[model samples]
Target: MTTTTSQATGSSAASDGRGARPDRRRRGKEGPAVAAVPVVPAPKLRRRPVLVAASVAAVCLGALLGVWTWSSTSNTHEVVALRQDVTRGETITQGDLVTVQVGLDPALKTIPGDRLSSLVGQRAAMDMAAGSLVTAAGVTKAVLPSEGMSVVGVALPPSLMPGERLLAGDLVRIVATPGQQGDLGQEPPATVAATVVGIYPNGENGETVVSLEVPEGQAAELAARAATGKVALVLDSRER
Candidate 1:
């Protein structure tokens, strides 16, 4: 009886031991972590590694964006840099110091298409607005033929014809007949050319006075002709 009792106790003890060991295993599996967690420090993921990774990603994205923009902007047109002295576009005003398309030379007096050749240092009058057609007249100044000359006139139709009858811009024809010369010589025939000059009023003869110039060599001949010749008045054509 004692032996059987002892055997039954042994079997019960082994079964209880096995069951407690399984409970201990379950408790170990349910435990939090191997290290003791402290209340002082809050758990935080490693931030520097994540931040570095994010920065690297941003730099990569920016580089790609910049490359895309550069590719799109590849096509470009030509650009020209204008110099301060070189003229091109029209200027706005006469007082405008920043002038362009200047008429450097006025005497070039070229025809229509040649106007550009002269616009160097010369300034333009206000009437020459920019982009407008620069006519030959607009680019050049008008010149009167008699600006520089000395003139002298004598009476025509013998002595009494009035000088007031003549005006400038009028054409005249000169005629001369031979005069008494030294004993055996014949006087020279009169020489003539068309003439137009400004006139000064001459109340002395109750007529206008006119001025004329002669070549130094021809003055004596002209005077001799004037002494013996007739001066006739004619009209000039207004067309030219």
Candidate 2:
């Protein structure tokens, strides 16, 4: 009975050993066990040209916005300007003036546009061309027949006048012709200086009546010349 028991125990031990070997063989055949490794994707490369273009676009937008803001903040002012040419001593009227918007400048002194009514009937201190900006220095209380001056009207026949039309403020000379043939050769034409104040056409006589502003002392002489109908006008460019 003891021998049988020993054989049975040896068989049991052999079976156990066999089972362990198979498990080891199976593990070896399957290959070594491996731990899972985490995979991390590399970062995408930056587009340098696209980044640079985006930055430049942002800068340009900023500059344009700044310029727009500055322009909006600046303001303009209105001032009075001449609608038509005004001669020295001529009156200012609402029809002869206009309002103009101008950039504000501290050095520029001009009549305000709102003072249109106050400037009316005021005489011009100087000859101002059309579209000129009205200023404080260009106005006066009175300019007609200024001190020590007189206005005289002279009738000039077309034959005795030049083709160029006479205008106010023109410097002219009136030469007196002799009344008789005997006196023509004896004396040269008497000349006098005058400023044209106004001119009117005389359709009846086909003549032009020119009102001249002359010195008080010479008014009588110019009138005498006009009465004789022997006067001729000579434009003086040097006085211009």
lDDT of 1 at 213: 49
Q: Estimate the Cα RMSD of every predicted model relative to the unseen true structure.
A: 21.4, 11.6
For residue 58, model 1's alpha carbon misses the true position, in angstroms, by 63
Q: Per-residue lDDT for 1-240 in model 1, tens only?
A: 999999899999999999999999998889976787777877787669888999999999999999987765663222211232212122222222221333334463323333343443332322343344343443323232225433456444424333344433445545454335424336553445434344455566544434444444555565565655444433445333
Give each model a TM-score. Answer: 0.27, 0.63
Model 2, global lDDT? 0.86
Candidate with top lDDT is: 2
Evaluated at residue 105, the lDDT of candidate 2 is 67
lDDT of model 1 at position 187: 57
Identify the leading candidate in terms of TM-score: 2
Backbone collision tally, model 2: 0
Candidate 2 C-alpha lDDT tens digits along 76-195: 678899999998756688899999877656777788889878999887878899998999899877666889999999999998887887766788999987666747775577899998
For residue 5, model 1's alpha carbon misses the true position, in angstroms, by 99
